[model samples]
Target: MHDSEDLVVVVDGELLTNTETICTGMKAQHASTMKLLRKHLKQLQTFGEVRFEIRLNPQGSDTEYAMLNEQQSALLISLMRNRKEVVSFKVKLIREFFRMRDALGQRDMTLWRQLQVAIAQEVDSAVRASFGSRLMLDRKKDKPILQSEIHRLESEIQPGLLLN
Candidate 1:
């Protein structure tokens, strides 16, 4: 609902990085870096959260950690929360709110399939609105696009691997 900023920390797969490293790196040269990052990120919105995703290597010997600032993290969390994965259906219903369900006639069993279509359209529109704008999209848009790109690659491999 509100706007926020996010700080992401991504470690290389071979490096076996995690939150501890980020905290350590930030605190190493400057002990209060995390505090600063958190403070700045929180100020971007009224309600914000932080998240960490670790992608382990294929050999299962190392792990790569991804740190997201609040805004970026929020967008990702929203996508993940709303994503109906492993589905053949291209359009999925994103009933984020109960009211949305009633509004889409979700209660009407007969309209269930139609509701899905509507939700799909809504999701497409929302994604386009958020991501389609070149002006609005940037490396620092909501999160570092680079980090997400790296994360995408990491997702393809098995966890607990040691990347070379």
Candidate 2:
């Protein structure tokens, strides 16, 4: 079987599958699938959040589609009886769910590192720009106070670097 990653959509940091895709995968009629979902809506909500998102078609018509996260999808699949294909498909979907989650986690870590590097560069630049000629020692009386202020600013920007 092919990977089902393309069939999954990420919505607001949650991996979701549309009812049309799930119905197609399970070889069930769309109406029947939707009926089953509505019947168990309460129970499914207890399991996890289920949402319906509205989208506009090319014809300017609004269509509401059900979106299910991994937990909700698994729960819905479990409710289906005597569907052998659905059982297998559920297993595959769950694996893909976790793979997507890991990918998202890696992306978050990369973004966090980039942010840290950006902050460090900005702090370094600010320190250099502020300390240029303004910190000259010709003004001996204000030199000590300026130096102490600079030290405090540096410590605030990056902890544990007190000047010797």
Candidate 3:
């Protein structure tokens, strides 16, 4: 693998195979693109770490019905070069989502949780469709975080500390 070439995973693309290699410039540019992709998909909160691999005679039997030809594959890589831009946008969106949830209070909690579940389902489906592999849902099996602690943390943190 050349320094410029790397594995890339996209929400709506093939699994990483051995033959796929993204160039350095392309990688740099795709950072933003990936971020944006994530931002849109994050609405589902179902997105997980995307895996990128390149291989010859790509596994045809895998799920996701991947039909990427060389040209299509190359185009996807080229477009992903600006990943950070997408990420920036996604961060903003996430914050907004949180803000909305918080401001809406308990009234919105049920709806928000439901939305989260739907997003998870979509991501699970997408992953299976792409890789034909069973997707894992990270269940928050642990105990719920206590509300008092939440308030304490929020109050204890000084405004200046946040920037650091």
Candidate 4:
């Protein structure tokens, strides 16, 4: 749908997509989509918040669009008068929306694993510094102890995490 453009996006940790996606997917004019949205604006809001943003294009003209959550977007699609094309696009969009949901879940799990590794690395670093400065005559013999601990943890931890 929508020529394979990204149908779903994460904004402020919220799952959302825009009206433009629907317009392109259904092969309808965006102007008509906006008109239908405005006509049923109240009905759309009944499902959830419908957000609008205005951006100045390269030509200095304002382009306005609505950023809708799952329910609002679904209802907006149902509101369209045409069905033959809209149905297929609507189905594709819904499926893609859920696919993105699962991907987000996987991302959260990966971040949690990364945090665990980072904590382990911090502990390893602290242990190394402390033992290295100790007044032990057999420190040379115990070098492998630190190596073993680091291996138990992992090879590396990224200095920072990425946020979306």
Candidate 5:
């Protein structure tokens, strides 16, 4: 649930604006907009930038609506009757789309960094486990080898590093 009236959602790496939201933003009736979209479905599909989904309504009824990416959304807006409200809505939608995109990018970057840290930790743990096994197998004979491995691992996992 988004608080912003002009909120645009990101679905499967694409910014999506549904028919209802578009109609509301444009100050147009939902039925009219849906009709227009259906009438022009072929043209929109030819653009290769829009997706349509069949979703179930809250009342358990099937409903079909077009989900448009940024490019397709812009194109659709351009093709619509150019009212002041529609133009203003288009501007807001574009802005929200970019903002959502940038936020998603930042989130992805953060998740990537976390994954790296997790992998490093797993590597460090594996190295320690190997060292422990070697120490148990050769308590005295492999002391030097174990020491060297420990030193290498310690250097690799320096203080404040990801592994540490």
Candidate 6:
């Protein structure tokens, strides 16, 4: 495997790995892995549909590979014998899924934060438009924050986040 290749990829917004990857990591034959998948195909389908893709091998032959979601992949690995390499690969696969999940969560939070800022800006714009005569604050004198400023500040106060 190449150092830059992703262990898991998002397909239809879900992380997935292919039998080819599993076989490579476990040092198992691709045909045997495909056979195992076919044998338990029904059970695997319970998690999600197993999409098969055909690719041209270096030898100018076509080969089929199954793309399995996290649950299906786990189940398939569990059905395989616990060879040392398989076990090691299983652990690596688990960590890859975990890392992907964490990354997605972080991305979601960032999008949420961005939405908050966008909404806040809209609200602040409305407040500014509503109060044309709104007085500006003087640093030396005591003055209250404008409604627009309040809305802008509120956007910065995300839940569980430290404010600077």
lDDT of 6 by residue, 4-123 (tens): 136688765679999888888878889999999999999999998899999986678999999999999999999888988789888888899888988877876776676566666555
Alpha-carbon RMSD, each predicted model? 22.3, 9.8, 20.9, 7.7, 10.0, 8.7
Could you tell me every candidate's TM-score relative to the true structure? 0.18, 0.68, 0.18, 0.63, 0.65, 0.75
lDDT of 6 at 156: 41
Q: How many backbone clashes does candidate 6 have?
A: 0
Evaluate model 6: give its lDDT: 0.75
Off by over 4 Å in 3: 1-82, 106-164
Q: What is the lDDT of residue 22 in candidate 1?
A: 34
Model 3 lDDT, residue 63, Cα: 22
**lDDT (10s digit) by residue, model 5, range 1-164:** 23343557866555677876777788887668778877777787776755677888667988777788777777777778988887888788888888888887787666566556655655555555577866445545544554555454454334235443
- State each model's CA lDDT, in order: 0.36, 0.71, 0.36, 0.74, 0.68, 0.75
Q: Poorest 10 consecutive residues of model 4 by lDDT?
A: 155-164
lDDT string for model 4 (50-145, tens) is: 899987745788888899988889888887776778788888889988888887778766766865765565555566656655624344445466
How big is the positional error of residue 70 in model 3, measured in Å on the Cα after superposition? 34
lDDT of 3 by residue, 1-164 (tens): 23211232222222231122332223343334444434543332232333344333344533221222233333444444347654443333334434443544553455455545555555555555555333322222111223333333333332234422
* Candidate 5, residue 73: lDDT: 73
- Per-residue accuracy of model 1 over 13-130 as CA lDDT, tens digit each: 2111223333332222222433444455554234334444556555575543445433433332333222233121112111122233343343244444444555455445446656
Best by TM-score: 6
lDDT of 4 at 19: 80
* Candidate 4 clash figure, as a count: 0
TM-score of 6: 0.75
